[model samples]
Target: MNWNQFGYICRVKSSKTLSTEQKLQLCSESHLQIYKDNGSHSELAHNIAWQIAEDEETSQKQTACYKNIPDLINEFKFEHKGWLIYLTAVFIIYCFTSQLYQSFVVPQFVEMYSSFSPSLSATFDYYLTYWYVPIMLLALLLIIIVMAIIKLKNASSLTTTTPFSGMYNILLPRRLRNEYDALIAIIEFPYAYKKGFKATTAETIHFEKCESLGLELNDEFTVLLKQKLMSFNAMAKSYINKLVILYGIVIVVSVYLFVKMAYQPIFMMGEVL
Candidate 1:
């Protein structure tokens, strides 16, 4: 992945072994060398970094740092997929069902308003009668929105400092705002058109699985992994933060529409009087 290359590049950046200017020049020269032409040094550096981040020599180690985390990754995947599907289903059901209620009830209420000056008491009657279906539906939708926000929150921790041990654990980017944006983060490639639902991941396999398939983990595996976690976390945090804002907007808009849909005629009656 392109992010993998970034991890390698960051370590070198941290090491201070090569001055910043030197690394920049090297990537620039290397870019020309590889493409047999000229291109962005930053892009070449990114590619070089990922090439250095692999587990090519991982089998030589007794216990790889990422060895025990395979189950964790799988469990995370299942949970993520489940919540994404559930959220989508909730929105779809609300769309169809809300349309039904709007079609069946609002026109009659509007017609009633035009025929006579309906009493506030009569309007309250409509609330009691018409509000039940959509109130219940809005509540259900609200719950799903809240749950999705929680899922995004749980999946967002990419870096942390264990103050006691001073150990840093690295994590890959998961649970992005959309699959295409997530893929861009993983591959470091651009897209002309990005499309997807609001929750998704790039296909990242655990290191143990890679080892089993005959790949090797390097000596700096944990550090490199941690670096990627830090790198991906920066992007994931920004994206998911926007998602939370989006969820909040949806909740507000849905509730506003529900209230207006359920009671616009009553308000119109008051205006008529």
Candidate 2:
């Protein structure tokens, strides 16, 4: 079922002198079928059961790393949830305010201002007429385009085999970089250890160097990386909270200015009368 259960079964079955099919049968059926179809002995389930079975300590380390994969993924999702919520709120409020300005505020003010200050009314009308909607729509479209481009580029760089691609990874946010390194270390540690490297030595290796050497995963390294990720998430939340407060202030100020501007023609008309 879950990774922990799957790992436990693998560890338990692997300890005995069971055939590969027998070990597969002992685990969850869904996982068993998937692994069978993939036909890859390098998969974690098979790797744990066959490769490091006799090495109890290494087996335990690999199993533990596999088990934490789900948790690390969950933590990453939770970190982004706050940002998505705030971004959605900003989008909704912008849409609602823009609708009110277009359908009610602009028309009503234009009518009222036309009776006295035609010149001022025409100036406001010209500025807010045809260009207003397109500008708003274009701004939104540009944001979406930029975000999509960045995502595509990041994905492409990550999949490339070039050793120099590590340079591109360095530009990612600290939290993202830490998360990527942690996951890579977790997945690749067993193979690296099997190749005669010590866990302690592997722990000290930089992620890029580890990656370039094709020996990029470890338990202690992931633990330290997780700590860094947690710290960054906390710091990121604090900054986002401050930004939300600042956004509220900006919205309030904008609304105040809109109200003042809407009535300024009336005040000028009264002065003339």
Candidate 3:
């Protein structure tokens, strides 16, 4: 009755002792942790279950799987809402600092230009002659373009943003289609496993699909497939932590720069005039 079904195929080393249930449980639990690390823990654990089938375990019962990509993407969108706040803060600070910088430096340059060129009776007219507006406008345009690109990249990364219907029609079922009605589970294996999912799953699927399609598993392919899942866990942990820390630092630095620039001119002018 569960119309939604999901699965992946994995190659097993003869030495690895985990039963199929144990493997599914490990992957299922780890996927939960990864999602939690990405945001505040949510009740959507049922959404991202893994239905991983192993090569050696063809005769084994299928594990219940859940497709959590939708949920995960939703949660990601929620978590990244802070980024909008950070960007707004950065923009406000940038505008305030830019104005402050021009204010402080402009008057001094105007006085110097007027004194040097006595014929320039009006300091404001002298300052206007240089046309700083175009340069500022160009800088503003560049900032907007860069911000637009960053926003587009982030938007593209959101899972649902892609029109998966076209490619999804071709690629999804070839791997998991034959697996019978089971809970469609979603699991966040490390991003490195992003590519490995297909190759590794293909190891098991090729063998399973072989009989249906008339093919056999190769020993060399089996050996290579076993390495992919165990490999990415460490790399994902390090990279994710580094990314979060860097984002936080950028937000803090933007705030500090804004406050410093806004106040320094008033303090200096008080002292000077």
Candidate 4:
């Protein structure tokens, strides 16, 4: 079953009504169990189940977070659906137009121009030959830059295994920084803590800071985390919108330039004829 169904079951089967072994058995027999062997459950579900069986307060916190997972995921998908559709449409259009021009339009135009003007035909041939060179080079450059950035990030001393640490280290706005911090603190760190894993230096520091500030890791904290998550999703959608617009502009401008180049020769040939 999906997380929503599992969460609903958990909610219905209150801890006060069920013993710790019952909760553990529920987790093991559920779809969350990845292996038939003893104690081999999906990490998140296992951690949540263990937390619930261990402490009443932590159980309440985890139960609240567990029930909200579906809403959180749905909200993210809803926020970015429009931009995703735009991106898919643009990609399809670009691919279809490029294929159609190369397969049908190019040959016809080359034949027509060749019969009328050899120079124009040569110009068309040259453009057709090299049109993709710059695009390929730019793509290569972007790949190289991304690889370099990843390498640098890996080599940096500040690097941690925190979920959003890479993004957190980037030059994000103060608001996004807070959201990333909250994500790590409320979600990831707690899971790691419950799973008996050693906290990384960054996680330890964040937890200390939260404690120093007298932050309670309660239902209110979960609500704050949910808000931060939604805010981050909104920011992600904004970035995606900007990227889609920028990419659409690039595609339009490239097509325009190609059309102008292709037609300019035809116009010159017409004038000569």
Candidate 5:
């Protein structure tokens, strides 16, 4: 059947602690063999034991935690959809601005220069005729490259998500803040949404599982996990803040560059060359 139905079956079947009636309530009929409702406790327990054993085996195999590369790529692509539109608009604006400058403004100014002096008229004509297109295209290409680098680096680099990487995921845009929130939702999807509860439950499950094995946790374990979550949140905020500042800097620098380039003089030859 559908993925939703499959997921329900998996979740119910995976829970050894669940009862037969509980399984019936939660799962559909087709998956009953995987999670038979009226089975003996010993049989149910055996299935659960086997399931746990299998889960542990798969967990060990799968738990060699590499980068969540696929999820990240998908998330990045989804997030950049709006950014793609924005980039398109920016490109259009740049093209329109460049065209308007060349067509209406530059020629008029050239004519005005020619009226002022025959010597300068040839220089202004050369300014428009030779260099304008290449320079504008180069600038636009550089901007696109720089923006691409920033986005790709942000998506791939290790930060708070890394184990013992010591890096933080701080400084982000509000949209990135939303992204982190979305990531947090994914992290907590197995449980209901409650911030403190999610944290406590995660900690409790971890501790209880280990404690059930009669293993003594180092005194620092709780402290460490708590610190990690706190650091993750802080770093996320910092990342957003940094992004905002970076965007501000980009805008400011871009405006300054545009104005500087627009007003700067263009000349072909020196005194005698």
Candidate 6:
């Protein structure tokens, strides 16, 4: 009851022409190869049951995979346990940092912002003189972070989301990317995002989701689904890249600022004579 089997199940139910042997092979061989291509084979191994079942009925009827919407929405769905753990860790970190910022940084920054009036002020108020540069950089950093989180979420899914409740899902893009990479061969869809890094097509994946949600697939629905899947990887990449940039800027700024404030040479030669 893993992605390979679930994909196989969906494939068996959705596909009208592919024979049993074809279905069997698709479940057994194709997805693993797909996993190795774009995602870590390790992730696939964590999510899939590699051994062939002795009977067809058992293979077809296995209930271990994610079945319905409720579980899918509320439960952990990644093929890799490590990613789930990692995402949980990040979410915790985000929560603490957000709290600390709200408690301490926000009030101070707010005070600084209030000093922006010309009639009441000099060129540099106490807040403005010390905080102006840090504030500007932090503002840029926060804007980039918010935008990246939003973009990453969009790339992985097209469903209604609850941000606070969905903390563990920050890593959804990575999982989706892996799925696309490994399953693209069986899915036969071009990776629409990164060069030489392919994933399953939305054309291939959207219907599976529709079925999971028990939604009827009509022309309108198909078009909507296609749009969601088409640029998902691109969105995910955009988000991940932005996050990387944010982290990089944060590290550089923190180090530079700390050094400037903590160490100052009052005299160039320090009374060398």
Candidate 3 per-residue C-alpha lDDT over 47-161 given as tens digits, one digit per residue, 9 for 90 to 100: 2222233454332222211232333233323133454455456556656765664678556645554564342325345234533543454345444434433432233223222
* Of 3 and 5, the candidate ranking higher by TM-score: 5
TM-score of each: 0.34, 0.53, 0.30, 0.56, 0.38, 0.30
Q: Is candidate 4 or candidate 6 better by lDDT?
A: 4
Better of 1 and 2 by lDDT: 2
RMSD of 6: 15.2
Pick the lDDT winner. 4
Instruction: Write one digit per residue (lDDT tens) for candidate 4, span 1-273.
Output: 343444554563445677766766765655444333422123444344444444655664446445554455444442333544555565666667777887898888787777862456665666687767545543443343334333322211112223334543553345544554555455555445546655454534555467458664444545655665666666644544454455656666777777887899867767978
lDDT of 6 by residue, 1-273 (tens): 333334434445334466678866765655645534332122222332333243554433322221221122223222223433443465456546645654686465455534645322222243334544454555555555555456344323322222223543454455555544433232222112122333345554654565457554434333443444444445455555656566557646754653443222212225543
Overall lDDT per candidate, in order of appearance = 0.41, 0.49, 0.36, 0.52, 0.41, 0.41
Which sections of candidate 5 miss by over 4 Å? 1-10, 17-78, 122-273
Candidate 4 worst ten-residue window by lDDT = 152-161
Clashes of each: 7, 1, 10, 0, 11, 4
Query: lDDT, candidate 4, residue 108?
Result: 82
Off by over 4 Å in 6: 1-130, 160-242, 266-273
lDDT of 2: 0.49
* Model 4 alpha-carbon miss at residue 214, Å: 9.8
Cα lDDT of candidate 3 equals: 0.36
TM-score of 3: 0.30
Candidate 4 wrong stretches, greater than 4 Å: 5-42, 51-67, 78-93, 115-118, 132-181, 188-218, 266-273
Q: Which pairs clash inside model 3? A: 48-186, 49-185, 65-183, 65-184, 65-185, 66-184, 66-185, 66-186, 67-184, 67-185
**What digit string (tens of lDDT, one per residue) describes model 2 on residues 1-273?**
333444455454534365655655666566555434322222333433444544544554455445454344345432444455555667576767777787887888777667763456764654375435443553454354334334323322222112124434443355444544544444455545547654432444554365457553455445754664454455444544554555556556556656677877778768988
